[model samples]
Target: MLGNSLASSPLATLGLAKCFHHSAGEFATYTNVLPLGLNSSHHGLTGGVGTSRNKWIVVCSTTQVETSSEDPKTWEECKEALSCFDFSVEEKDKILGKAFGHIHSPYWTEERAKESPKVETLNQILEFLRSLGLSDEDLHKVVKKFPEVLGCSLEEEMKPNIGILENQWGITGKSLRNLLLRNPKVLGFNVDCKGDCAAQCTRCWVRF
Candidate 1:
């Protein structure tokens, strides 16, 4: 039965959004992100000298954040982090909005929201995905699908799961990349339990 669910959707057995939740302590370590001291004036296209014209700009809207508290300030950091990607302003807004909503829902209290992952962590997640050979379009789709991924611990969660997919299931290169796009939720699974999870998925695929 578990294998059947994995064959249908790799994350269905784990419960969709529940897989992403972790103890507040897991997020506490990331709360000290150095603020960029950003303000309404900082909103605009950002490109360093000699940088390629194709690079996307960090476009911050004055209206994106409504307060000066730590929670809202985290949104500013998120906007800065997303600037490193190739997404357009509109795309960035959508991604940022989704992330903002996810972290602010009833599931996340004011304290947890304030302790959310910072700019540096968010960039690390994006860079890791890019290293996996995801194009800009694919990256956008994954982030939009699983905004909670921004809060995941790279060393603890993402890498281990990818390792299981490669070493255990032999899913690599293009096949691995396509699988991730189809089921970005797989990244949220706790690494310690992922081996058994992937094993079940393997059995289901073999049965088919």
Candidate 2:
């Protein structure tokens, strides 16, 4: 074991920090990401197990959505499979007991945008969450409230990976993260890489 923070971190353990930092870049600067397990995956070596976040706090959307996955990679397929639905925010309790935002949206068909009254929103909530380095417990709570605004929505066509979500995941986490990075408007989630931006992103992530 290379190291372990009181909280989890992408590079918590020196065991994989050297390699993980080289690839994922900005997604590993945090002090809360844990190396739940080891993997001798694709590179003929260890890869992220992707099971650490096996449980999710499913964020409920105010509109009709077929939420099959929230993994980065699978999100594309989900959007493609999606048919347009009128946007609306759902009601839910607070997370970390901190006041979170969820504005009502008459964000309806392209036709209604001009007429409907706009409201406050959580467009950048995910970014704030990542910056704070919230614990899994808090994260699960946050995700559970905003199904409409997932940090990373899954692709409708991605294959299921039970080892990842432990729930009814017909998709994987990598796919979900992909979706998160791609759809910044929904969550504004950033991938924190280590070494390069570690010093800077860390300061920003914390200060924010």
Candidate 3:
């Protein structure tokens, strides 16, 4: 009689609705006897008025999103992947975190990590930038800000563009360094469109 009264009450259904949306971790608590098919998985409820009186049910969904699978690889895998590049543990940590400015990007996946571009090519680019007078610390900062620079063409792209900024625009040495720190994206700008590229760089420079 008590179970039938509770199950048929509209107030009990309202209370159940309130419980469902309470919070992520909390769950509704109730006790009742009902027909076997009275509960609904979609409606998130169980129990009903039935003549059987011998069965009870509890229904809820336990689905949860998995975030760990999104991570490309472990720290050890990152170190091993970059093994041929002469990076220390600390340096590897920085490189992994700042490679694409956000380690969570799809580029950090295991497949992409395995297919990383040639270490020798990246070394040449790093060396050229170092030759341009950026210290190791400054180079890391630049790479952190714009990791795509590692994949840029040195002869046809980076050199000509950097030369124009320093020579044509008179942004050399300290000024150039300041400009890079202010907007590292300029390093990846297309030098083929020198006018547009220089205009964008100038605008960004003026803003800072």
Candidate 4:
């Protein structure tokens, strides 16, 4: 599902609106997100950057307490921890989002280098994209043009495609190809906001 959050950089969101040619911020629903503090706090999720890196990002105020308490627990535990009165609903939403975003099946979390690519399935997906009128040249152009800044390979980032492994990289898959075809812009990726937004962006919050 697409979100209307201005959390994305202006250029990307604007370009997306222009591409789809519709205004949709109010129509889009906010995903689950929660704020959390550093590992020293009681409510923060545990794990190292190397573990969760870029898989999910958290936005929180500096005054908030960060904790690793939720890190060691399962999703059920994390869900409960989010209700503690020490934090507000808005704050809890942010932290929960990060953990949820990063919580993949143990299979996906393994070192990507060691995993085998789903070559056969990827080929069929690639064929599907081609049938949709996306040319080989276009696919190459789009994937290469985007650089998939957010994923190790576009396929690794999402289970739906193999195109991410391509782009001239040794990877391969087709599920990603379809996903990219759907949201080609995201293939370009973005850097983390580091939980701070110094650049003002028209009070992007709903402030509900």
**RMSD to the hidden true structure, all candidates:** 19.4, 22.9, 17.4, 21.8
Q: Which ten residues in a row are the worst by lDDT in model 1?
A: 47-56
Q: Which residue segments of model 3 deviate by more than 4 Å?
A: 1-115, 191-208
Each candidate's TM vs. the true structure? 0.50, 0.18, 0.42, 0.21
**What ranges in model 4 sit over 4 Å off?**
1-113, 146-208
What lDDT score goes with residue 194 in model 4? 43
Candidate 1 TM-score over all chains jointly: 0.50
lDDT (Cα atoms) of all candidates against the true structure: 0.52, 0.28, 0.48, 0.33
Give stretches of model 1 more than 4 Å off. Answer: 1-74, 84-114, 191-208
Give a tens-digit lDDT track for model 1, residues 1-208: 9777666852232222111112333322222112233333433323111111211122333223222233333554676677655665556544654444432533122423423346777778888999999987888788877666666568987898788788998999999999889888677565243334444331122221
Better of 1 and 2 by lDDT: 1
lDDT of 2 by residue, 1-208 (tens): 3344523763233334222222223432211112324322222222222333321121222221111222322322222222122222222212111121222222111221111111112323433444434444444444554333431223321112212222444433455444334332233223234435544341122221
1-208, model 4: which lDDT tens digit per residue?
A: 2455544523223212111111223221112212221233422332212122112222233322222322222322433432423444333433333222232222223422322223343344345545545676655544333322222343433323334235634433454455555555443232233447523221111110
The TM-score leader among the candidates is: 1
What residue runs in model 2 are displaced by over 4 Å at the alpha carbon?
Answer: 1-73, 76-128, 151-208
